[model samples]
Target chain A: MSIDTSTAARVAKLARIKVEDDALPGLAEDFNRILGFIEELNEVDVEGVEPMVSVEPMRLKRRVDGVTDGNQQDKILSNAPDAREGFFAVPKVVE
Target chain B: MSDLTKLTIAEARDALRKGETTSAALTEACLAAIEGAGALNAFVHHTPEIARAQAQAADARIKAGDAPALCGIPLGIKDLFCTKGVPSQAASRILEGFKPEYESTVSSQLFERGAVMLGKLNMDEFAMGSSNETSVYGNAVNPWKRGNDEAELTPGGSSGGSAAAVAADLCLGATGTDTGGSIRQPAAFTGITGIKPTYGRCSRWGIVAFASSLDQAGPMTKDVRDAAIMLEAMCGHDPKDSTSADLPVPDFEAMLTGDIRGKTIGIPREYRMEGMPEEIETLWAEGRKMLEDAGAKIVDISLPHTKYALPTYYVIAPAEASSNLARYDGVRYGHRATLAQGDGITEMYEKTRAEGFGNEVKRRVMIGTYVLSAGFYDAYYNRARKVRTLIKRDFEEVFAQGVDAILTPATPSSAFPLGMEMDDPVQMYLNDVFTVTVNLAGLPGIAVPTGTDKHGLPMGLQLIGRPWEEGDLLNTAYALEQAAGFVSKPAKWW
Candidate 1:
């Protein structure tokens, strides 16, 4: 359960957070402390227990596949950092 | 009455109806209180113009004899809620300058009932931290001082500002979202009444999601009855939020008959953790006696999975937070990072997220991503999910044995000093240890402030009810409130 620098770097990458090399040790230490606390769950036997994904056990509601609302592109894009030509603007991906 | 600001929502409603006061005057009084209590930093945004308009409209509606339940009542909204044109940051720099165009369903419901919104309250960044220190604005100072000491104390989090506002009488009632005791813990710390209704009880369409499965909106108020009254307006089925319960919204206040005769309240033995302070134990016992004197049978019960709740909540809440936060990449909405030479979209996302999120938020997102990674999913994420089921079942086993409610202390201890809980995340996480199990079970739980510690910091007793049974839970808490006679308020130090 001990998180080393390499594993901490990998987790930071997966989370899309850029952790400096010096910060990796601190991150690793934090992860280790959290994991150490979490390891207490190993005491109980959960062999036959089912996982609870949500408090409400109901099925997700099925919706009609019709577009009941649309054409508010300006409103949706207003909060975007960059928008152009009625679309969300971002760094070039295909280039 | 001397101060209209000191009145509870119920009392304010009566005053408005009897023509003793107008909503405009009450709103002005609350706004003045917020201005005066600037040191506490309870409010992050001030909407005096909006408040005046709503209050005047409420007066018009009342004169027309068609006033709604919450007409003219001024309240504080947790920053997590999307407040139409107001900035809703969830107390994070990531959402700086972003104003939601549409109203969230919960706030919209209150506004529809003619409730006046004073402003947005502060909270932990994305409701991620227990202490209010994580808020970008600043930590919210609790109105209660420790034994006349001048040192500031935390109001608790992630709904810290809401709790402080209600406690300081800046607002009659405030809205708070609980994902692992955000509402209840602060309510307990600040000596007020707060209830986290069933998971799907209130619509989540507009509240910013932290842990989607566990996040629920409820009322933070001056007393149990005010909690009941405000909670009814905040709940309803919304097509916008599919998870919103498709059930009738009950008149919770009307259901509070304050009679728990023949009721069975369970005392979960597992909640008696080792090293618990003697004061918390005494307050819990006093709560039991109060219920027993009210004719309810107190039985010993065991929720065996209780100890695992904190760890389980950490895993599940972070995993969901990482997924939900992925939408905040540079391109669409929120803060965006400037690109460097040869930077691509990946760099844009990384820099945007890393720069936008705070230290605690980054820590959680990293933990979440690590646990849900391909190799570690089975070990961490799935294991915690299973533990969550066992935790839920423990409550079921107790309730099935004719237990109408479970009673325990709301928090391990009352409000500690602001920066004291920092440096150790586990020590901070322990604040929610007694409260998280209720959220994991998707049941209603209320924190009723009973008495104070030797330091004069307020302590609370929690009562947990079966799913969608807040009416019964509030009635039980009402009986306790009557017996405890907890009329002590934090002396105006703020």
Candidate 2:
């Protein structure tokens, strides 16, 4: 499917990445080209073929729900751009 | 000592064992070489203090007679793997100044085996680009120039820096991750050896996520045996990464017997694409002949779905990338955009990603988001998944027919000029044509430098092995490496 500037703008919004109006056209063009290339897969007849969920055929390992490791609050917050009072700080959401 | 930095891992291991050379001397030699080779820009971070400390510890271990195979060997790590307290940016602005509090499993495994870290290597931003040009630290230049043209060429990506570091002898070996030809392509371009083992072979925990299913850490080294040595150390089961296989990793180096008598090697006719460079074609033929002379039977085969592999990879990788990258939203770590007076969290995330990611990464995120969007999910994402199954099936059919391995050219051409294919993204994507199918099929593949093009740039041939049979694949490559006798170096252009 061809993606236009408006659709590209919508996708940018969905992706939470800001794209200016002028850049939308270029972004749309890139999307169109990539999608155009990907469109080649349409020729393949996938009738009765199963989608590959995993490359290897192994059962997913499960464990009893339990906390394996934690409590290093200082280390976890060391790299935060903004940390306050043992928590990651963000723009206030509640009034 | 005649340049201790030039010794291979095997040679260095022997010397260390025999008390002929110390790890401290080897580490100092590598650090000095890295200091002088700034022109290539392969290393993005230098860890001399860490290297020296690790070397001292390794020397002590050797004295106690408790050394591992990689004891005291210096190696470069691609910026993609997170090393504790080191800047691990994945060659993107998004992760600027982001040092991890913990180490990636692969890096930690290497360290535990007594490997020394020389520094972090550069790569395409988020491992998204085929050439190293998209790296934030700038292109990692290929040490091999085309017959003294003096124009900088690319060490292929997204493991370009790893390839460059190993090829230039700046380090004995380096770690590389492949999603779709990242390791093998760069290895081919730089005239080194790289292998991408079967999916689930290496633990994915602590590595910056790319395409999760396709991404795997491997070794880029001066030769096939080094590749085997480093790969064995790099692979193991991690409870943290559920996808990591529980089976034991074999002694890959010990399996390099270089004997392929009565083995069957498949030459996929489908890989003989239109407009393939005559040099690459000749190299493939020579590889087949070498295998035959080593007492193997060569047969023409067809992987009909080969052409669709790239397109399928593009779809699936991006879709996964979009989901994987969602976590980098100006959160606990990494670059966060400055906000205005009334800016909310939404605005913060939008601005942060837009300013943080490079053009290629942005384009990929956009394409990935679009394909997985509501109206197109089935048409794009699901369709690609089905196509992926067929691609995998094609390899299974061939292997099931008793084909032990497949031989093909590693890349379509030798290293091109730095900015050659920037204008067309599709053209850049075409570089992985011969190598991506192996990733899609979840099989081990290695690129061994076998010959050179007319311009004196090294070209390589790839060997595709059966599932979970990296030992056999490496052995076949060992045989080819012995027969080809490719001893040419890049002539110290840097």
Candidate 3:
């Protein structure tokens, strides 16, 4: 499908990235090219093929279910721009 | 100390063991090298005092006969990995000042083995670009040169700085994460050796998630053996990473037999597409000839689903990435923007995220969100996943037919000009076509320098091995590396 400027704008909003109104055309063009490239896959026939989870056929290794964090909360929060009461502080959302 | 900057981790360790060099001396050498190469833009941050203190501790440990394999070995941690007390922005304005209290599992593992941190290396914003040009911190220059024009060739990202630093002798070895040729391509571009072990080989606990299912941490180094040594240290079971395997870690170094006698190496017929440069084809042919001369059998195989790999990866990776990066909203961990006049909190959120992430990152996030959206989920994401399965199955069938490993070009072409992709997203994505499938199949692959192209730019040969068979993969790469006899040194140190 041809990606229009409006579609491009929606994509940008969905992606949570800001793009100027004038740049939407370029974004739309880029998206169309990517989609065009993706369309090339439709020609390949994968009838009985099973999707590969890994190069090796071994099952994923399982670990014991446990709840232990690295416990460096203060160190982790050290770089926060806004912190309050030992948590990341943010602008209030509710009245 | 015999110009410690040029020493490999193995050489440094031997020197330390024999009391010929101290960790302090090694660390100082690296720090001096970093200072000397300041214009290369290889580092995001440096901690000389911490490095010196760590080096002293390593010396004390050596004196007490308590040294681990990596004790005192100075290495660069990619800025993408979280390092306690150090800013760990994935080279984006979104994470401009973000730091983590805990070190990433791979980094911490290296530290436990006593590797001294030289500093965090630079990368593309959120590991998004092929060239380090996407980095908010500026691009890393290719250590190698063409003429007097040091117009700063790309070091290849998002692990560009890691590859450049190791190649430039700024660090003995460096950590790199490969999601889709990130590590291998850069390694190839910079004339270094890098391996992306089978997915889940290294825990991804604290590393910033890129494409969680495909993201894996590995080592970038001057030689295959050093890569092996670092890989050995980096692999282990970590309960914290749900996807991390609990399998026994093998002694990768011990398995480097250097003898590929009678091994069957598959040369995928599909990899040599029409547009591949003649020089790269020649190099691939030369690599196959070298392995055959070493008594290995060569057979032509087909990965029929090869063409679908790039598209499948583009869809799956972005789909997962969008979900994984959702946690980075301004309220929790990254930059926040203020609402404009007449806008409210929701608008504030919209503004913060839009302003925070870079263009490529935003593109991926949007692609991901679109594919995962209710209406398109089946048509895009699900279909891509099915194709991914087919790609994986193709490798499985080939390996099942007595092929010990597969050999192909790491990339279709050599490093393009720095700004070549700024106006062309398709061209940029094509750069990863050759390397993305291995990740999709969750197989181990390594990129070794094959030879230089006509333009004198370096090209690489990628070796794909069966799942968890990194040892065999490295062994073949080591043999080819020895036979190719392509020793490359970057242009004169700035």
Instruction: Give per-model CA RMSD.
Output: 1.0, 0.8, 2.1
Docking class of 3: medium
Q: Report backbone clashes per prediction.
A: 0, 0, 6
Give candidate 3's error at residue B281 in angstroms. 1.1
Q: What residue pairs are clashing in model 3? A: A18-B354, A51-B389, A52-B389, A55-B441, A75-B101, A76-B101
Per-prediction DockQ: 0.82, 0.88, 0.51
TM-score of each: 0.99, 0.99, 0.95
TM-score, candidate 2, is 0.99
- In candidate 3 the C-alpha lDDT for residue B354 amounts to 79
Checking candidate 2 for backbone clashes, the offending pairs are none
What is the number of residue pairs that collide in model 2? Answer: 0
Per-residue lDDT tens digits of candidate 2, residues B398-494?
9989999999999999999999999889999999998899888889999999998888999999999998999999999999999999988998967
- Evaluating just chain A, the predictions reach TM-scores of 0.90, 0.93, 0.78
The CA lDDT of each predicted structure is: 0.92, 0.93, 0.86
Candidate 3: where are CA atoms >4 Å away?
A: A46-77, A92-95
TM-score of chain B alone in model 1: 0.99
Give lDDT tens digits, candidate 1, residues B274-340.
9999999999999999999999999999998899999998899899999998888877678999889
Off by over 4 Å in 1: none
**Tens-place lDDT digits, model 3, residues B1-494:** 78889998889888999999999999999999999998778987998877888899899999999888789999999989999878888988888777676789899899888899999999988888888887888888888766555566888888999998998999999999999999999999988999999998999998999998899999999889899999999998887786877788887878788899999999999898887888888999999999999999999999998888999988888888898887777776668786566665556666787788878888888888888887888677877878988888789899999999999999877776677677776678788878999899899999999799766778899999988888889999999989998787876658
